[model samples]
Target: MQGLDEQPVQAHNIDGFVFLYSEAQQKRYLSSRKNLLGHERVLEQAMESGYRTLLPLQFGLVIHDWESVREQLTVPKENDLKQLFAKLEGYREVSVKVLWDQSSELEQLMQENAALQAERDRLEGKNLSMDQIVKIGQAIERAIAARKQAIIGAIQETLNPLAIEVIENDPLGEDMIYNTAYLIPWDTEPHFSEQVEALDRQFDSRLRIRYNHLTAPFNFAQLS
Candidate 1:
């Protein structure tokens, strides 16, 4: 064994003897470490030059022409190489497993989004049906007709003073009419119920008398 300080400067076989360098030399090598492209260039150049470089251990100096110097550079048996290849395959499997898990999570999220979109579309369709403008128009027409008939019947029976002209019989429907205002006096309002009751007894089956007294422009007898 040679002392650390007195070790031979030059190595006999680059592969057989491990190169030992000072701390300063190690730092210099670290600083000179090549990038990916530089390393690829170095490998290509070395292959063309018929030289192989190898680092024995982490702290060992780089050895050029390792095959010429070291017997260990001799190719191993097929089975030995296969076992090393299997270890690398195991590392690849672990990486694939991690990626597959992430892919599964993404697939689940995509399915959930699709379901939400479908539900939203269904709700939108239902809302459109409920708020349909044609349906609203039909309902308004029916309500107005029913209210108009009620007003007409109430006027005929409750204030039977004179000619109740149907001057503007603009019926929105069979039951509803527009511009069917009455002509009745303010004083006859006290006897309004007696007149309405008399009409009710006579035409109760034929007409409906839903009366709400309203202010009129003229007397009941004058309009008649």
Candidate 2:
């Protein structure tokens, strides 16, 4: 029979071999001084109980014939396995610790979200108030009316003839008018300008004439 430390023996070619623990046999060879002769005796007894040699590699001891090994090897009962229970307890403790940390973080986020929602609700409430909304709408209407009046006055003042036909007026403002246009005779423009200048002096602040180029009513020849 070849021993385990006898130069890495192949199990299929060997008639029989004794498996030894590398822990017990510190040496790599069967003939070395560190070879455990006492453990070899124990392994021989185990092999007689129907245990068969299996291939050995890098990992820990692997022997076939489990039933024979079970009968020969002494192991603790399930109730007396303290090390297994301790490992499971440690895993449970770590899992609980992780879950607790996650729960605290979730709660803090929920609280912050709730505060932001409350602030949003307050702003929405202010925006939806009937009085506030009505006031804003009224202000906008007034501004639009003022702008329209200004545009009409500008158009009326810029056109020649000083006779602006008023189409619309603002009910709220006295001088504000809308859609006014001017009409002037094409030949009388120079004379009309002298009269307009005199009128402008008379009512400089009250009435202002603005002139714009209009298409001549009819083209007139120069009277030389």
Candidate 3:
């Protein structure tokens, strides 16, 4: 929550939401990661702090000097940062990861994927053409893609009503369907988490729903 260089790394309070970052090292050593205490910890500290609102900087962001921090945070981008901060002042951020069990999902999919199975059976004979095989492969890929979209879509539909904003993050692994961050009002966090807990129970059989961490509105502010 506090230094990029040898100095202390406390995040600056800019209108309750914007936090300016200074320069960091070119290489990331274990020592440096330890110095920053890892991104999650830093973010957690900021959110838990007494600040009315705090904007998180992206991982490994740095400027050449303190001058850059002051300049970029204050006068840069025609003060769009300030405007964004003002817009985000009363909200906070939370991480929610939705992971499906590939084996279980795959099993369910296969039972429902008769066309894909038919294509596979069609390819078994040595008489198959290369173009046919390629087409079958593409078909399989399309089926999987469709299933993933369906699963993530249902999840999004379940939560979208509660979120002020939601940003999709890159999936962490093959089983990850959605790695999302939500912008929620500070007072509404309990209801948000309650909904997540219900989702966890509902998806217990096939998906792992993790309500990860609270942090500054990094995703909402487009910090990463």
Candidate 4:
């Protein structure tokens, strides 16, 4: 297999388990996006090579030798590894990110709340103090946060049934309503996708849902 440096990655069998690896400087893995993607490609290739079940190491892990790898997989821990493989068998992850138009949502909020409208009217065309502006900004921030929580809750309620496990990742920015990864059986993907499509249609004007399907179960398979 070709790895981060496009060098040969050899496979070693240790107690009935296979470890595919390539020798490289640790700094290479930390260098750039290209190396990161290349590392991920190596893992994807390993899984695609008729070994459907895989537990990925933490990114940038540099085990110096075969003995280190062997020691990491030995004895009682080996049973745990096998159980993890069995648990993840026939499963993949689907990642979904929901983004909302902030300006649009704020406009809707402004139209809906009479008190907020009155507050805005009070401050309009006035030479305001910095304290007054800061308070107004804080109120707007709170309003945005509350709306995001409600929408995200509704999304999770709709999609949770189809997934074996749902992981809520930290939202990246102000416009992101939620970022989540779902662990699901391969057979259930069609139904899961249909639900996502239905949601997209439901919120088409205000929100955009980004759905990525059939990805490796990285979120679910974190190892120390």
Candidate 5:
């Protein structure tokens, strides 16, 4: 493990637990995006160090010394931390993102809905006013949202039984149909992945499904 300036990360044993840390001036690592990469690197290394369970600190924590580390972070929160660790044992976090071809979906919607087909027909080969175009666009947006929600619900239902917990995040763009995180027992990860693969094959033409192979349970951490 290495620090922001490439200094080796060292471990300090305090009150029966080991804290992995590196020597650095507190101000140097605060509020700087570049330094955040270094902070994440140290955490990533620690998380991959074969520990069965961990409680990760939020980024930008600026404990000045080992004494401060113990008194401020570990000592007071020891019991709660232990509980969190126990609860998180044997589980891991993974995320799935689903993207659809918007044009293809919209075309299907238009084909299925007579009202939408009529609206499109009304605009065909016409010098339509901006208001008319805007109204039609809004109607299409509503239809897309409704269809997207239904698909998300269906997918979640298919995957929920395999997970210990499910978290839904807002979709980022028009192409994104669903964004979600799942917490599952470590042993079930392979099976969870197989289900995701089946979903990919199920939506082979219209959607793309992706899942993270390694993650730190950031979503579950908040709950714990």
Candidate 6:
């Protein structure tokens, strides 16, 4: 709880976990909080309080009045909310974003893919037909897809032992392949994060791995 107040975090104890909100003086502070930093701190506080499960709210969740809070926490949604809390009791969300280093990946592909090399050689000759060019382009694309798939598969395999569920997010860019999240137990987080470090090394400077353990379980807890 050290420095808990120093940061722009002001919260309230709700039904199952602490809920963070912006106070009158904290309005500007909350507005400026970017990248969900304060929101993440709320999740950390929940975890510290022995509430392994959490119903993570987005940042900038401001409670305008106490009545709304009471109504939301009471009878109507109470039972269902408790069920969610129960389900998430032992789980914590962890995120992993695997970014492809295009230059490095392309270099590796060009070096190891004999077919692409052959295609390059064929394309080097003068008077190549349009169909030949298309075929060579298709071959290069397929080779890149195959290699990317293998990398993702290896990452999933590395994380399978530690995660309860895997959730894939939309890729960030042409060079970025996977933006995934996992629902792992509170106890296994250390091991899972360590595995990510191993993956970063195994990719050998070709893939950049970023992980956020304090992320909300939104990826896993999305409602139907």
Cα TM-score per model? 0.21, 0.23, 0.73, 0.85, 0.81, 0.81
- Of the two candidates 3 and 6, the one with more favorable TM-score, higher being better, is 6
| Residue 154 displacement in candidate 4 (angstroms) | 2.0
Worst 10 residues of 4 by lDDT: 23-32
The residue-by-residue lDDT of candidate 6 on 1-224, one tens digit each, is 32223445456766544555544435433444553565566678767777667687645555678668768654467776677777788888888888877777777788898777866976696788899878878878888889999999999888977877787889988878999888888888888878899998898878878888776688866543
* Residue range with the least summed lDDT across 10 consecutive positions in model 2: 90-99
Candidate 2 structure quality by residue, lDDT tens digits, 1-224? 33444432222311122334333233233443344443343344433443422222222244554454434431322233233333222111000000012233333434655754354445564546777567555654554456444544443454333432212222223332332223333344455456545645653454434432322111111111
How well does candidate 3 match the true structure in TM-score terms?
Answer: 0.73
List lDDT for all candidates, in order: 0.36, 0.35, 0.70, 0.82, 0.80, 0.74
Candidate 5 regions off by >4 Å?
30-48, 125-135
Per lDDT, the best of the predicted structures is 4
Clashes of each: 4, 4, 5, 0, 0, 0
lDDT computed for candidate 2? 0.35
Error of 3 at 113 (Å): 3.7
Clashing pairs in 5: none
Candidate 1 local lDDT, 130-154, one digit each (tens): 4554654454445444544554555
Residue-by-residue lDDT tens digits, candidate 4, 88-123: 999878899999888899999999878887898899
Tens digit of per-residue lDDT, candidate 5, span 56-143: 6677665656788688767887887777777789888889999999889989999889989897898989998999989898999999
User: How many residue pairs of model 3 clash at the backbone?
Assistant: 5
List model 3 lDDT by residue over 84-144, tens digit each. Answer: 7687887877888888777776567668888777667766866878898788778777777
Deviation from truth (RMSD, Å), model 5: 3.1
Top TM-score: which candidate number? 4
Using TM-score as the measure, name the better of candidate 5 and candidate 6: 5
RMSD of 3: 4.3
Candidate with the larger lDDT of 2 and 3: 3
- Residue 207 alpha-carbon offset, candidate 3, angstroms: 1.8
